[model samples]
Structures are given as C-alpha cells and as structure tokens.
Target: MIAIQDVKKLSSEEYLSQEKTNLIKHEYINGEVYEMPGASSAHVTIAGNMFFLLKSHLKGSNCRVYNADMKVRIDRLNVFYYPDVIVTCSEEDKGLNYYKKYPQIIIEVLSDSTESFDRGDKFADYRKIESLREYVLISQSKKRVDSFTKQDNNLWILESFSEEENLVIKSVNFNCAVSSLYEDLD
Candidate 1:
C-alpha cells in the first residue's frame, strides 16, 4: 500500500520538476503527490509477460509498448501515472519528454495492494484521456484479462477473457491467444 503523506502541496509544474530528481516514484494528482509502492514478483512477472507479448506484436507498427518506467500525462485530470504497460500509436507522443500525453492502450497488472485504486481512482483518471481507446487489467493471480473499450459515443464497453479464450484488440487490429499472455507466469 502507498503511504499517504500530509505535506504542503505544490503546483503541478513544481511537482513535475521535482519528481524528475526524486529517488522514489510518486504519482501526481492535481497538486498532491502519493508515493507508489514497488510491485511484487507476481505483479512484475505479469507486467513483463504482457510487455514482451505486446512488444513482439507491435514490432514494425506505429504503436510502441512501454513499461512502468514511462509516465502518462492525463491532461484532463492534470495528473500523471505510470501504467504497467502502455501502447501509443500517436506520432506526436514520440517527443523527448519522459511523459506520454496520449496512449491508445493502457494495461494495469492487478495486485493485492493496489487493485482497488487501480480499478477505481486510477482507471477513472485514465478514462479522461481522449486518445485512450482501451484499458486492460490483467490479474496476477489468475489467467484473466478485462478490457474496457470505448464505443463510438465515448461509452466504455467491458469485455472479459480467460485462459480458455482468445483476446482481441480491435483498436490495434491484433488478436492473440489468452495463454500466450500468461506464459511462464506460473
């Protein structure tokens, strides 16, 4: 669980500048900051598996896969998050900054400590991004993936897939076996 501190808040710009030099990872929301905890072995493994799978699938395509080290900027909410895996096909996102303002797909590996926040507040914040078409949640304890895709009218539709099924990402025109997504994670 992340430790909630009661410190004097700073402007978003100040928080962003200070975050660059800070030793620990801090998620910025509005003017407040919250320290992020390190992922468990299972969490890391799941994230790594997804990263590898997505990277291989996206090779030679305009989309790029990034791990948790990259920060995503939610302009509408004025916040930044380090998603477990992010796929961005936006040409404008290829700039020099370590932050990404637009992402077509965002994946979050669920953990016991952060699952609630990831599903509730973090997911809520991520939905504010206009460029986000899909949000994926991978369970660390099971072979399941939950995807929320945006419809034409901006409504999000939820789809769940298990190891017995295939997962399709229509936004990126990609489909893969669900087993492949959970490979070597046991």
Candidate 2:
C-alpha cells in the first residue's frame, strides 16, 4: 500500500522543482505525493486511441488534446495531476507551461493498478476545478466508457456507455461511434 502524508505546507513551485528525476510518475496533492505506476499495454492503447480521435476532431478549433506528460493544476486545491489525456478550450491554457486550472475534458484509461483511485479520490479532487466540464473513465479490459458531466447547478451526472451503443461528450460538443474508442485493443 502507498503511504499517505500531509502536504498542506508545500508551495507548488517547491514541489515542482524538488524532484529532478524519478523512475515513476508522482501526483502532488496539497503537499502530499503519491507514486504512479507504469501503465499496461492495453491502457496505453486506449489512451493513444483517444488522443488520435480527439486530435483529429479538434483540428482547426481552439481546443487541443494533450498526452500524459501535460500537467493540469487545480489551483483552488493546490494540486497537480498528470491526466492520461486532457482537452482544453480555454485561451489562457493555450501556451501556458503548466495548466493553473482544470481542463475542459479529462480522460483516464482505467487499469488494474489505478482503477480505484482514478474513480475515487482522484475524481473527487478533479471536481474541485471549476473549469472542468467532463471526466471520462475508459475501461482498458472491456468496452466501457463512464462520463461525468457537470450540470447547470454545479452537480455532476454520471453516464455510462458500452460496446452496444454510441456515446456523446456534450462538454466538448463531440461524438463518435463507440467502436472508435475501443478499436485495435483485442
């Protein structure tokens, strides 16, 4: 099990600069840090597939898609997370070194090693961002997609899609046949 520590005292700059190199990725929350494990082949495939589809669809538009290395900041919570895939339509986020805010769309390709946290505390932390419109969790082992969209009253609604049907992401005004998201994964 990963040990949890209190991190309410560290500055964002201090946290970013303190770590020079590491074998694994680490997520910084408040002042605490947790090591992230390497993803499996299936997980990578899903993420890559989503990136390709999103990238093509968002072309010539203000929105852009970023891969795993991009860091998204939740300033209100003083946290930084490396989302598997992030889509941003805000002009301020276009050339920023670090996203000092939440993304319009955040997607995590679920894997055995990180499914629980990805759906639990991580989602909780992400909700704190006011700019975030949708949170998506894509199953790496099965053809499933879970989407959480923020409602008019700032509440979130959960929507799930399987292989049998199509899914639409109202947040980004994007839609695709479900098969496109799970292609080449067998």
Candidate 3:
C-alpha cells in the first residue's frame, strides 16, 4: 500500500484555517493530517458522470449536489474530508458556508491509492453521521458500485451492482444504468 502524506498534528480549527489558505486539500483525523491525493483519470471521469446525473435529476428541488471542493464535518470523529460527490437536502446544511453536517448522501470514487481507506476507516466515521442515509463507493478499476443504506435499526445494508445492472439510490428516488457511469474510458 502506498503511504498517504501525513502532515504535522493540528487542531480542528487549525486545520480549517490551513485548508482555507492552502491550495491543496487535506483530511484531518484526530490531530493528524493526510494530504488528499490527485484522482486518476478514471476516477475523475466517473465522479463527473455521477455529479452531472445527480444534479440533473435534482434540479429545481431542495437537493443539491456538490463536488469534492466541499468539506464535510464529521463532528463525532473530529474529522474533515472532501467526498467526491455530496448531496444535501437539509435547510440547516444549506445555510452553512464552509462545511456540511447533514448530507443525505456521500459518494466516493475509488482509486488504487484511496480505496482501502475510503472503504474502511472513512466509512466508519461517515456512519456516525445521523443525517447520512447512504454511502456509495464507485470503483475506478471496473464498472461497479457498493452502496450502503442505513436501515431502521441502524444496520447498513450493502447492495452491490456491477456490469450492466442499474444502480438505485432510494434516498432521492434515483436510478441509473451502471454503464452510464463509465461512459468514456480507455
């Protein structure tokens, strides 16, 4: 596994200030900071496709889709990370300027470097968000998605879609063919 750059320890406030001034992106967990890596071409393409599809479906509605530039505050874990795509329908979250707390859906497009972290520790932190209903992970190596949806008893059910299957996002009543997510590639 490749090492993700680990900067010096910083407070949550300190990290935010650094992020505001610095051009690069970083994720803060506890007091440690990890610089976010650049996305692979495949990663970027998939994320772009999903964002456009989500934005179009949600137009004129309260739901809004955001790119990775938006930071999400995981208060329970004292972490701040940028997801590939985030959809928030909460009025309170919309009122905020810097970060969102109540995102209904968070999508992360996986690359070789970040897939394990995105699927493991990062997911654990995301699950702590009370307002989060779905977490979706899209694979850059293949046409696949693994979605976790929170159930009534707090258990998250995993649904995997691959090949030509349709990916369904029940939170927003949205579904799209998996092939659409990988429109252009080498």
Candidate 4:
C-alpha cells in the first residue's frame, strides 16, 4: 500500500480518534497520518492463508494472532502501522483494543509499491520494538518467505524459504509449508 500523507499534522490522540471513525485505514508516522491503500486479491489471499495457519496453531495459547486490521504501536518512534499479520503474547497488550505494543511476530506481504519500505524503513522501525522476535516478509507474486529472526545476541539472522521448504517461526513455535501460504492464489 502507498501511503498518501495528510498535510495537517495531528497528535497521537487525534490520529487515534480519527482513525477509528474513518472508513479506510491510515498509518501514523511521528505526527503525520498517511492513508493506506487497499491490497490486491493475491495479497489478501496470502494474508488470509497466513492468518488461518497462525490462528489455528496458536489457539488456546497465550499468543493472539491478528490479521491486517490490528495496528502495531511503536511508542518511542511515534509510529503506528497495520501489519499483514501479528502475534502478541504479552499480558500488557490485552489492555488495548485497537493496537498492539508488544508483538512477538510481524508479517508483511510485499507488493511493488510497498516492498522497499517494508524491507527497509518499515523493517527498521519494527526492529526498535524490544518484544519483536521475528519479522517476516512474504511474496505475493512468488512462493518465497524471508524471516528475520532475532538472535540472543540482539542481532538478527535472515532465513529464506522457498515453495518446497517448511517456514519456521521459532518465536511462535510454528511451522508450515511455504507453498501453503500461496495456496489457491493461481
């Protein structure tokens, strides 16, 4: 999704309030709000597939899986973004209904318009979250998944999986075939 920035600067409170009432979603970056465009059919399908796998795997566990609509809050950076999928196990995150502050896993399905930002700036922003254990980027146009797993040393390691491989998200103790994420998207 391409972010169309709004010229008028708004506080966090104002952005949160306006966001709830707005029909479409908008991301908050610092003090500026940017409108998020809609996703394509394949993007939506892949996200749904991922959400289904995660939700079913994490059922009855402490972690809660959210798809597309839940916003991730980066308080220190003053940024809020809606990831394609997110998982949070923190009890503190239960207090908020609209957003999550301590997500263990964040997944973004790449598009031509947002691929660079998702891989660069957005990934940089998400790395600031101490609670984030894994950041995943999935390709809608291809059957590939790249996982950036946080190491014990506070460094990150990249692991890529193709269609035949099993994608493991150690943070959530979940694994699935990479092809499953692209199911029915022909």
Query: lDDT: which candidate is best?
Result: 4
Candidate 1, 1-186: lDDT as tens digits? 332445677677887888899888888887778888888877888789888888988999999999998999987887888899999999999983778998999999998888899889888899889999999998887889999999989899999999999888888887878777767665
Q: Which residue pairs show collisions in model 2?
A: 7-31
Best by TM-score: 4
Give lDDT tens digits, candidate 3, residues 33-151.
Answer: 77788887888889999999999999999998999999999988898889999999999998878789999999999988888989998899999999999999999888899999999
Q: Please provide, for model 2 over 23-77, each residue's C-alpha lDDT reduced to its tens digit, 9 standing for 90 to 100.
A: 5667788777767778887788888988998899899998889998777888878
* Displacement of the residue 2 alpha carbon in candidate 1, Å: 5.6
Residues forming the 10-long window of minimal summed lDDT in candidate 3: 1-10
From the highest lDDT down, the ranking of the candidates is: 4, 3, 1, 2
Which residue segments of model 4 deviate by more than 4 Å?
1-6
**CA lDDT of every candidate:** 0.86, 0.83, 0.90, 0.93
Model 1 TM-score (2 dp): 0.93
Give the per-residue lDDT of model 4 (tens digit) for 1-186: 434555667888888999999999999998878888689999999999999999999999999999989999999999999999999999999999999999999999999989999999999999999999999999977789999999989899999999999999997789999999998886
My TM-score estimates for the predictions, one after another, are: 0.93, 0.89, 0.94, 0.96
Give the CA lDDT, 0 to 100, for residue 123 in model 2: 96
List the candidate 2 regions with Cα displacement exceeding 4 Å. Answer: 1-10, 19-23
The C-alpha RMSD in Å for every predicted model, in order, reads 1.6, 2.3, 1.9, 1.3
